[model samples]
Target chain A: MPSRASEQVINLIEAGLRDGSLKAGSRIPGERTLCMECGVGRSSVREGLRVLEAFGIIRSSAGTGPDAGSFIASEPQEGFSRAMAMHLLVRSFNVADTIEFRELVEGWSAAQAAHCEDSAQRDAALAEAAALLDRMDDPKINQETFHDLDMQFHTLISALGGNAVVDTTLGALRSSVLGYVLAAVKQLPDWRAEVEILQKEHRLLLAAVHNRDSAEAQRIAVQHIRGFAERAKIGLQQ
Target chain B: MPSRASEQVINLIEAGLRDGSLKAGSRIPGERTLCMECGVGRSSVREGLRVLEAFGIIRSSAGTGPDAGSFIASEPQEGFSRAMAMHLLVRSFNVADTIEFRELVEGWSAAQAAHCEDSAQRDAALAEAAALLDRMDDPKINQETFHDLDMQFHTLISALGGNAVVDTTLGALRSSVLGYVLAAVKQLPDWRAEVEILQKEHRLLLAAVHNRDSAEAQRIAVQHIRGFAERAKIGLQQ
Candidate 1:
């Protein structure tokens, strides 16, 4: 549990945010103001501030001038992604649950990419994904490089889905499972057959996106993930 | 970006988790061991450990003993929820995107709850949800309490969906938007009508879940949330 002082600091900041008094790029009240309002010592205030900073809620500076103090941050993707990835790494969440989540989020992302974003942007993103599929055909490519391309291709679709939450979220889910995924691929008895099947799935998904077939895109994405999940059969003990 | 030493710490833990060398109840290497292995100072190792602890990936202690050192954590919800709620407080994501995500996850969770899980467990979970609806019908319930109950009702369904990843993910997403959701409810022009309509929707959803109608349950969940989104008209602002 968080200490009372730290919780107080968090509640105060949340209150300010709720009231629109604090916002992106706005400086947090300095230590003295926080100490008075929170009725805590300088050390407590600093400790609370450190927690926020570590969470990426605030960024601070050693230099204390008008433009050089701690400020509430707008960029949340990095922090959220890091936390999500770390939590997924703890092994409490099983392989099947991760695959289920991936199917849900990635399916939603693919469908939304075809249906939600503006046409030109959606097409451009799909085209980029298609290009990645083309690159994956290289005979000389190592498994790691191939995996990165696969991630990049799917990340493009997620981003183009036009929701930051989904993009950041699906990205984190993918990363959490990525190590095991690569290991599974490396250990496949029929590596060439695996690559062929995965690339075919990607092509079908990309083509559906290019055609602006939202339902088909979603279906393909889910089926593709299901195929991988079945083939991987990843155990808790790697 | 994570510092090199911090990244090293993350990779080491991830590798262990992947290979089954480290596990849920196991402590990571101590500070001295980490310093030597990571080739960094004591401070860097401590910083890396702090980051993991803050993310709820690990739990730590000040006391020095075999049983008192850092160990991998099972509970990721509290930390993830805190991060999500704080980020949402900053108004970084828009209302439309939030609603879209809720619809997707809630829809999938409802479908899964209806289609998967043992019949006895599913009925029991739906019964609990129905009971919450009954409690919501009381006129004495304040808007704040009603909102919390509403959240609880949805969280129960998400958990019973039998996917821990979905359960935790949707919980964080709902919590992230909860403050604004309650505020939106408080400001509704026709509060009584809103309550009646929401209860009706909840009843229909519970009925579908009870009947094991996966598609209908999913449809109702999405439509119900969409109704709330329309009523709230929640923009980027509170």
Candidate 2:
């Protein structure tokens, strides 16, 4: 019941990451090895690995060989997204606030993409957004898949925004809001009208970017967000 | 060695919060009581309380008898900030990215404040920002305290942006950048010159907000951020 062993293990692993003692993709010692090295019970070592895995900081595979132990994970974005989602859920944050935050970050991202200090990344993002809009016309696309594509389109713009921190924060926030968004959509009797409105707004927003009109882009983005939130019927509590 | 007790405790408390078993400002049972209730050892109970306290989910005051036990803490912001700071440190994030992220959020916030339909909040924010700028002229104000005031000014704008997610994220990011910003400023041989430049930009940005010109406010705010990043000799990490 004394869990001090677990905390020490976590501290050790974190220290390893910070000091560059454990690089991405490096394998951690086996459970037995950790038990011996850290002088904790094997059960405690396993528990520490479980915590790391839950945090998306490590990956585990079972086998009898030497390579069957835990390994450091390189998917930083996954860890970030999960951490953010858990925090949002635990806090019972307002969904409207999340949407508004997205509007701000994504608006700047769109503006930056339009300016295209580098033409290639800008063109790629614009093309991706356009492609997503084209796919939105398909009646066969399930709501779930369509939502995933929608996320990609937005993520592309954020990636092109030329700000890693903004991109990461917005990406995580968007993912966290997915449940609220889907629940809102499921409640609607007719999503066609809602989808159409958003599509038109997206087209205009993309055009605004193509024209390097930052003001128009920002305005359209905010309006688009507000419209979606309204459609979702999420109140202040969400 | 069985740290599952800690995880069990976390799950129980989170469930309590979700299911309304625990309300804000309510007192939790003492260690002995929790141990009996949770079917775990006292040490395990204490460890769980430590983790919860670390996350600001609960608070414990040291005393004996009636007032010494744990009480559920209602404030989520402290936990959010602590998680954010730890996340950044673990990621070994670059300072430039954090500044750029702050700029994007704050720029959007300034623009939102300018275009806010709620004029009262806008006016209040403007007054706060103006007060900070006015104080910049006082030679008696030390840089450290002034930096904190400057944070409050920007924080006021984020709050006025009408988004809790944005406000919290920007606030946490701003706090994370404080160490690096102060270090950079201290490195400058002629620090007053940099302060003057930032002050002029701040006044101009506030003027834009005062005029309710969202576009100008956004532009000035973004430029102010970029300019400061440059003065600090930090690269955007292309």
Candidate 3:
């Protein structure tokens, strides 16, 4: 429900973006300047800037120096994650749909990783994933640490697919439900046992990708994800 | 880059959302009340509210009437689409990656539609898709009209998968690159011929789904998408 004046400001900025006049790191005009350019009041300009900042399309600072004021930004992940979490909170989309979507993307990513053409790059990625797994193996670490590493492992596997859209969307999805996931883990009857099983599945998934078995990698990816959701009774409410 | 006070406001609202106190359509406190609650100034409260509105977590109206205050909202699609488009503008993710991601999701959705257990719902969706195709086949339609129907057709197929996340994300992705897609269509050397080819593919795709040929449905979905991108030389820069 942005005002018409604010919408004009947004439209002007979007036009600049599409025509290449604006770019990441480019400085945006101040409120006064934008008000004149967009033919809107200062309040409208500020409102439009706030919307842009919330979307991570721009970053702003307050000072009288050269570095102050708004600049174009490319950090959409934070905004996307926050917005998605809010959407989930409002029940616009349910957990089961999210789990299903994640399964498809993550499974496809794993399969693609298994079939990667560059052996050197693929091996390096696998090695990085292995390192993450080793960290998860440390029994003294807290559940939060384990969960953080777990997300990194899955994100790394998706990154190996070399699709930025998949990588970003998957990362956002993981972060959106992070609190629910952590709470579910804490509620588990035997956290240690469940961790062990998750670790084992991770190892098998890595091995499938390492051995270039695309089908097996995909199958394991789907099973590992759905199994955890089922075990935690996370998305069953839908 | 929200100020500390604004961050507090966002955190408080998020907590309310998590605890079920801030359901959709619930009216948010006014700016002065929020400022006092979050121990911030009026500006900070407005900033926080703007961020929430940009995320589509809330909507506000002018005046002091009962319905004039901010209310929790669930319209995340507009914000998500705008952010994604801006991300694409800044080259955070390229067109090729978006196209690839779409192929994966849409192809899987088509296959799901083909294998759908509920024949009545499946047939209804397929008939809807067919109706869209019929509109696209109209010889007098403009490119914009044709493009709109084309997107609707793809979106409907994805909806048949019954995954809300997929539906929303696919719809956002389509909207995010809409201008670029339309421009590409206009640039085609033989627009009518290309349209004819796309129509044939659409008809065949619908037929495959109707026949419950999951494999063929998926195959056609991918080919139709990739084929158009290739023909238009779109997303070839990567």
Q: How much does candidate 1 score in TM-score?
A: 0.88
- 2 or 3, which is superior by TM-score? 3
What is candidate 3's TM-score for chain A? Answer: 0.93
Local lDDT at B181 for model 1: 83
Worst 10 residues of 1 chain B by lDDT: B1-10
lDDT by residue (A1-238, candidate 2, tens digit) is 1156865676677678656688668888777778877889876776566556544567776786877767776655555565566456555356667766777777777776566564776777788789988998797777787777878877876576576677777778888877767767888888877777877887898888788787787788778877788767765454
Cα distance off (Å), candidate 3, residue B224: 1.1
Instruction: List the candidate numbers ranked by DockQ, top first.
Output: 3, 1, 2
Q: On a 0 to 100 scale, what is the lDDT of residue B205 in model 1?
A: 83
Worst 10 residues of 3 chain B by lDDT: B74-83
Per-model TM-score of chain A alone?
A: 0.87, 0.84, 0.93
lDDT by residue (tens digit), candidate 3, A1-238: 4778888888888888888899888899888889999999998898888878777788887888989989888565676666677777776778888888889998999998888787687778889999999999998989899999999999888888888888888888888777778988887999999999999999999999888899999999999989999898888866
CAPRI verdict (incorrect, acceptable, medium, high) for model 2: incorrect
The lDDT for every candidate, in the order shown, is: 0.80, 0.71, 0.85
Real A-B contacts recovered, model 2: 0.20
Model with the higher lDDT, candidate 1 or 3: 3
TM-score of each prediction: 0.88, 0.69, 0.94
